[model samples]
Target: MKWFKKYHLELLLVLPMTFYILGFTLLPLIRTIILGFQNRYTGKFSLSTYQALFARPDFLKSISNTFVIALLSLSIQIVIAFIIALVLKQRFHGRSIIRAIVLMPMGIPTIVSGIIALYVFGTSGYFNELLFKLHLITKPINWLTGNFKGLLIIALADMWKVLPTLVLLLLAGLDSISQDIYEAAELDGANSWQSFRFITLPLLKPTITMAVLLRAVDVFRIFELPQVLVGKSVPFVSTFAYEEYDIGDLNGSGAASTILLLMILVFAILWLKFVDRGGSFGNDS
Candidate 1:
């Protein structure tokens, strides 16, 4: 109470944002939880929705595929985005031009990116066409078929679309870090790799945590890339729920949504535990 009185001005500025987040998040979450437990045809509360959802092999496979793609893509996005951020941090001529190119993918509409990916990875598309003409293969390979290939294509497509936003976030973190620490480490005989490992990573942990949280949440609900790329063959959680909802199976959709929410919850819990155990890694001072 005394702290609130002492910092009342700060509290006043923060209260609006606090309320805004609670209003947008808490209410919808309560509604979804309620809907998830009800029957699509009847309003009765029951677990039949979840039972039926789990009974379908295709739905289970979709869940598995969704996890596999999201995990792999998240890993790849972090690594690549980190490397790109590092490169962009370097002093060079035409750096703005290069940064613009790095950011160009995000400017393209997702549907357009999906369409471009379709052609780029299609059987008769440039990938196979180039390979065939070079005598590297016997025939055109279906790059967008089969779960592994499909996931790879989807991951690549998503990387192009989403990587820029993450890269920019990481870049911001990198920019926030002071250069003196690296110079001091260099003076102490630390090489590039050693300095990066000792200084950059520890200081960047918070930004990485924020990036992972946001990416995990968004990727868990991924729809368009898989929808346009593999259609019903590779159903992500979002696509599956969307299909169920479109068919008037509101409860079923809600059940799938609950599962999606659980996945994000589990990820967030585990990640927070890891962060907590690791202690504060981002204190620059």
Candidate 2:
């Protein structure tokens, strides 16, 4: 009680966030879990919702595609962002302008990105027109019409939108490092590669882990890009849930959403464990 009294002011600062989380996150979570096992179709309780999900032919494919999209998008975005961050951290002309340009996509809504993608990659769109002018292809390729290619465009849109934020995260990590460390390495006859390997990377592990976890979690809950670009009937889990909802399959939608939530939670736990093992998220320096 005495300890609580001493920290009353500190605790007060977290009150708003606590209520926000409870209202928007915790309450909805409890409602969803309750609804997931209910037979809303008949106003009863059963596991039939989950059974229905598992029975669908494309259900397993949707699960697999969800993971593939998240993994591939995360990997490509991180690698590209890391390289760009490393380059941008160095002194250069118009660096701030370039940084703003990279991050501009993040400022745009995800739905807008999908619309932009539609313009650029839709059949007879600008990309195909350019290709035609350059004698690249006789006809415009349908970039957003098929399963595999549709998924690819969705992933690419996500990659383009997220790359800038990832770059900023990595850059902040780079800036946290002291210049003296690099100079000290130079004095020891260490080259750029050696310095980066021994000093920059090891110190930046925390930031990298944080960025990856954030991106992975974001990718999992994503609906806009995939839904807008690929349509609502495709195998993406979110779109599946949408279809369920459209047909008044409330319980089924809840069940699928619960599944998505579970997936994200599992991944978040694993990521936290990995970060803790590496001591990346700890306050120790």
Give each model's clash number. Answer: 0, 0
> What's model 1's lDDT at 101?
94
- lDDT per residue for candidate 2 within 1-285, as digits (tens), equals 999999999899999999999999999988887788998757687998788889987777778778888887888888889999988997999989988888888888889988999899999789899999999999889888767787778888888888888998999999999999999999999999999999988988888888988998888877898778877545777778888889888888888889999889988888778654655655657
- Tell me each candidate's TM-score: 0.86, 0.88
| C-alpha local distance difference test of each model | 0.88, 0.85
Q: Residue pairs in steric clash, candidate 1?
A: none
Candidate 2 lDDT for residue 166: 91
- lDDT (Cα, 0-100) at 75 in candidate 1: 92
